[model samples]
Target: MSKTNLPNESIETYLIRRRALMRLGAMAGLGAALPGLRAQAQAKPATPLQFVGWQYNPQIVAQNVETFEQLYDENVNYQLIPGEYAPITETMLVAGKKFDMMYSEEATLARWITAGWAQDVDSMPDVAAIKASMVPVGVRNLSLPNGKLGGLPYYAGYGSFIYNEKHLDQAKLQPPTSWAEFLEQARQLKKDKIVEFPYVSAWAHQAPSFSWSLFSIWYSEGAKVFDANFDPVFDDKFTSVLEMHRTLYRERLVSPDIFTLPQEGVPSYATGQHTFAVIHDYDQKVLNDPKLSQCAGQVRNAIMPGATRSTFSWVSMYLMGAGAADPDRAWNLLRFFGGKAKDGQYHVIKRWALQFGLGTPYTEVMNDPEVAASFKSWKDTDVALQQLQNSTPRDVGKTLWYQDWDWYMMGAVQDYIRGSQPTSALVADLHKQVGVFKARYAT
Candidate 1:
C-alpha cells in the first residue's frame, strides 16, 4: 500500500508502528544502542497516574480527581502520593521511581529539564486552554521558559502583611502604609504594652511560610533573589533593610522567642500574644479559629509594606519535573492543577490540597461573594494577587534553596531582638553567612 493511502490506523497502532520503525533504525546503527532505544519506545501498563505532593489536602484531592477522571480518557488512572514539601521532592529525585506527575517549581525545573526528564506536551490543545484560564502573572511565573503555563497552580496565595488590628487600636496607632510606618506601629504597640512581646514572625520554623515572609520583605524593598541565571542574593536588601530588622530586634522591639520558638509561634500571633505579624495573605485561618486566636476580629490581612518596592509569593510556582515516566501524564496534572480544565470538577485536588488551608488560587472560587460572605475572617485572595502583580519576584540571588538560610537568618533576627546579639554584630555575621551561602549554594 502507498504510504499516502495507508488504511486508517488506531492511535495505539500508530504508536506501535512508530516504535518499530525507530527500533529498526537504531538496530541499523548498533545492536547495543538499539536496546536503550527500544526501552524508550516501549509502553508500560496503563495504570493510574501517580502524583506526590506536599500541598495535598483531602477535599482538594477529591475535587481535582473527580474532574480528572471525568475528563481523562479511559486509559488514564489517577493516584495521589502523600508527602510533605521538601522531603517529598528530595525523596522522589533520589529514589528514581515512576511517578507520572511531579509538581514542579521553575528554579528546580531548569535543572530537571536540563537533565532530559521533562516531556514536552506543548502541542497538547489543553495547554493553550489552561493558559487561557489563568491570570497574566500566573501565566508568566508558572509557564515554560517562564511563559507557557506548564503546571496548573493547584492552589496559590500571595505573601503579604497579616497584622493584628485590635492591638493597633489599643496602641492608639493607625494601620501602617509603608515599612517605616510598620515599624513605627510595632514600636508604639511595644512601648504601650499593648503586646508584651515585640512583633515575632517565627518564620524559619515554617520553611515555606518563612519564604513567604522573606519574599514579602525582599520584594517590598525591590530586591530579587533570581537573576537571569538564578543568582541568589543574600545581601541585596534596600539600604539598611537587613540592618533595620536587626535594629528592631536589638532594640528589643521585636520578639526574642522568634529565635527558637516552635513552628506555631508566629502564626499564633493572631491569637493576641504579639501585637503584629508579617505573613502570607491566605493564612488568615488564624483569625477565623475563634478558639485558637484572641485577635479574631482584630486580625487584618493587607498588602505587604513597601520600602523601595512591594512584593509577594505563592507557597510555590508549579513547574515541570526533570524525569517523568509519562511526560504527558505529568503535563496533564500540571494543566489540571494549574487550573486549565474548564470543568468545575477539575478544582477537586486544588480544593483538597487546600481542603483545610488558606490562600487558594481560584480567584473566582475564593472571591465568590458567597465564599467571602460565609467566612467573615476569610482574607481576600485578591490582596496576594495584587501584591505579587504590583511587585517583582523576590531576591534569592543565585539560588532558590533558602531552607537552611531562612532558619539561620530568622534565628539571627530573633537573637538580635532578644538582646542576645548586637545589631552591628548581627549584620556582620549575616554578611559573612551570606557569602558562605553564596559559595555553598549559588555558584
Candidate 2:
C-alpha cells in the first residue's frame, strides 16, 4: 500500500518516521527570517513560509493563500497531506520537518502540544481580541491542558438533530422533543411505511462521525462520559443509550447498514429514504440544498432531544508550529486564516461559513446578517445557533491518549451492539480501559 494509505494502517506500524513519505518544502534560515517575523513591513528573505494542511477544498485554499500572499506580500509554500493528516504530520514533525503553520484537529491537539510540536497562542499580542471573537466552546477546544490558547478555529460546530418534515407531516406526527418521543415518531413512520428505516446514522467503527453521534446522544441524555479528573463516568446512563441503539436496530427502525455507512447518512435523508439523522450542523446545508438533496425543501433542524437538549461540539484549528522559524510571520498567517486579516475582516473564516456552510467561531461572523441570511437558504438560523449554545466540547479530548481511547471505544460499541458483550460487561470494560490509558499517560 502507498504510504498515504496510512489511515487504514495500524498506528503502531506507522509510528516511525519515513522521510520518503514526506513532501515538505525547503526549510529557511531562522536568522534570515527573523526580521520579517518582527513586522510584516520589515525586510524579508526570499524563502517562503511553509504552510501545510489536509485536502478539503484545495482550490479554495489556494485562492485564499494567493489572496494572503497579495495582501501581505508574504511568500507561503503551501502543501497538502493526502491521508490521515495528523499521523502523517506528526511523522513529518518527528522526522525533523519544520513548518510555520499546520491544520490540527481537537483530538490531536493535546498530543501535538504535549510533544512540543505546537506553540500556544495565549502569549500572542492579539490573543485577547482573538479570544473575544470566538464562542466559549471554540476557546475551550483550542486551549491546551494548561489553559493556554493553543490555536484558532478553522471551523467549529456541533452535532445536531435533523429530521425530514415531509415524512413527519405525512405520518401526521410532530418533531420529537425527547428520546422517547423520537423513538415513538420513528415507529410511527416505520409502521406507516413512510420509509423502511425511519432513522439513519453514521456509526461505522473508527469513523469520526461515530464519536460525534455517540457523544451527542450521551450529552442529550445528560451523561458525562468523563469527569474533570479524566475518569470514565458514563456507566449509569450508557445502558439506556446502548439499549436505545439495540432496540432501534432489532426493530428495523434504523437501517441495518448504518454500521457500515459514512457521515450522518446524508444520502439516506437527502434521497428521502430516512426521516431522522444526527449530524454536524454544517451538513444541514447539504441536506437542504436543492441541487444536492431530493428532500431539499423538507429537511429541517431541531436541537437534540433529551432533558437538557444538549450535544457535543468541536473545533478544527490552524496551529502555529513550535518549529516555526518565523514566529511573527506564522502568527500573521494563522490570524489571517483563523481570525481577522490585516484588513480587519475575517475573510477566510467568513468564506468558509457563507460559501460552504461550515461553522465559524467568530462572534461577529456567527451574528453577521449575511451569514444568517445564508443559513436561511438551507437551515433555520435560530435552531442552528441555539444548538451551538446548547453544545459542549468533549473533555476527554484534552488527554494525550484521547484518539487511542476513542478508537477502542468505537470498537467496543460495535461489539456491544452485536451482542458480543452485555451492558454491564461493556461499561465495566470501557471504564477499565479508560483507567489503563489514564495510568499509561499519567504525569
Candidate 3:
C-alpha cells in the first residue's frame, strides 16, 4: 500500500519529504519518552497489536479487547497513557514509536493526517458503505482534504445544559428557558445558599474544553464560531456571551475554580457543589450513576438556555497508525471496535452507548431500543436527543491549526474572566490573534 499525501502533494515526493523531516526531528516533542513499547518497527500476526489511550473507562476497554482476542484468536497489548493525549501521541509518532491504533479527537486527527502520522482509511474494506452509514457530522469529521476517511468514530456527543433538580426545587425555581432566566435562577440559588456557586464549566486551559464551553454558549445564542469559509465570526454575538460570563464570575454565581477544574467537574456536580453545567451530554450517565454520584437521581438535561436552543458537538475517533505493520489486521480491529464485530452487531459501540451513555454516530445504534432504554434510566431521552439534534460541531475546529489556536484562546479567555481586560479589548485581541494564526498556517 502507498502512503497517503496531502491533496496537492505527490505520494513519492511526500514520502521523501516526511522521511527527511522525521530524521531531523522537525516535530517538537510534547511528552517524555513513552515506556514499555516494543522496540520492533513492525509486527507479525503472532505479535500482539499495540493499543494506547488516555485513561477513562479502562475496565470496559480491557473487556472489549479481551472479547475481540477471544473471538478472533488474536492478541493485543493495550496500554493507558497518562496526560495530554494528542500532543503526546504526536511526540511518540515523531519519535518513531509504533502503535497499531489509538484514540484521537477530531482536530487532533486532522493535524495527524496533515503531519503524516495517521493512515487514511479510504482503502479499508467496505469503506464507502461504512462512510454512508454514519451521520453527516461523523462523515465530515473523518473526511480529509484529500477526500479520504481519516478514521472510524469512537464516540460523538454535544454539550448539554444540565441542572440539579434538587437545587431548583429548593430554590423554588424552574429550569431556565433563556440565558437571562438562568442567571436570575443562579442568583436566587446563591442568595438562598442552596449552592455557593450555582454554575460550573470545563474551562481548564490545559485542555481544549474552554472552547467547548464557549461554543455551547455562543451557539445557543445563534452564533457560529467560524463562517462558511472557516473565518472567525463569533464576535458578532460573543460580546454579550462574554459579559454573561463576566457577571457570573464577578457576582460569584459560578464556581470560583471554574478555570481550574477538570472536564465538567463531575465530582463537583455529583456531590452537589454546583447546580448547573454545560459539558458533554454523555456525562449525564456518570453523573446519574448511583455508585458514582451523590446527586444521581436529581441531575437532568434541558435544552441549552438561549434563543436558538443550540449547543456545540464534537466527535472523537479511533485512528490507525501510518506505520502499522499489518494493515489488514489493523483494519479488521478498527472495524470490529468502531463498527460491527464478527457477530454482526455493533458490539463495542453499543456497549459504550448502553454502559457509559456515550453517543454513537451510526443511525442503527442511535435508534437501538436497548440503548434508548438505557438512556431513559439516566436522562430525559426527548430533551437529550433534541439537544443532540440542535448541536453543530465548531467549524473553526476543523482547521489544522485549531489545537494551537485553542490553547492560545484559552489563555485569552482566562484573562478576560480574571477581569484583566474589558470585553471590547479582549475581542480585539482575539481577532488579531486569529489573523496571526491564519497567516502562520495560511488556512
Each model's backbone clash number: 36, 0, 0
Query: Alpha-carbon error at 168 in model 2, in Å?
Result: 0.7
lDDT of 3 by residue, 1-443 (tens): 10112121332222233212222122223322222223321233458777776555544676777677767766777765554566776788888878788888867777777777778888888999898888886777666655688889888888899999988888878889899999998898888988888888777775546778888899998877678777777565777888898898889887677776544455556666678898788878877766666677999999999979998887888999787888887887888888887778888999878866889889889889899889899999999777877777765675787767777888888888887687888888877788887778874
Query: RMSD of model 2, in Å?
Result: 7.4
Whole-structure CA lDDT of model 2: 0.77
Write the candidate numbers in order of decreasing TM-score. 2, 3, 1
Query: Candidate 1 on 1-443: residue-level lDDT in tens?
Result: 00111121332233233212223233233212212223322234455455544323323343454556557541333333333444555555566644455555544444444445444445656666656565665555554554434455645555556767667766667667777787777777767777666466644544554555666677777766445554444453632566666666666766554544433243346436666667545446644455445456666667766765476654354555555556666666666665545455445433433333444445565555655554444555456456656755432411434445655766666555445554567766765676676577554
Model 3, backbone clash pairs (residues 3+ apart or across chains), number: 0
lDDT of each: 0.52, 0.77, 0.75
Question: So what's the TM-score on candidate 2?
Answer: 0.89
Which sequence of candidate numbers ranks them by lDDT, best first? 2, 3, 1
* Quality of model 1 by C-alpha lDDT: 0.52
Candidate 1: worst-modelled 10 consecutive residues by lDDT? 1-10
Which 10 consecutive positions of candidate 2 have the poorest summed lDDT?
Answer: 11-20
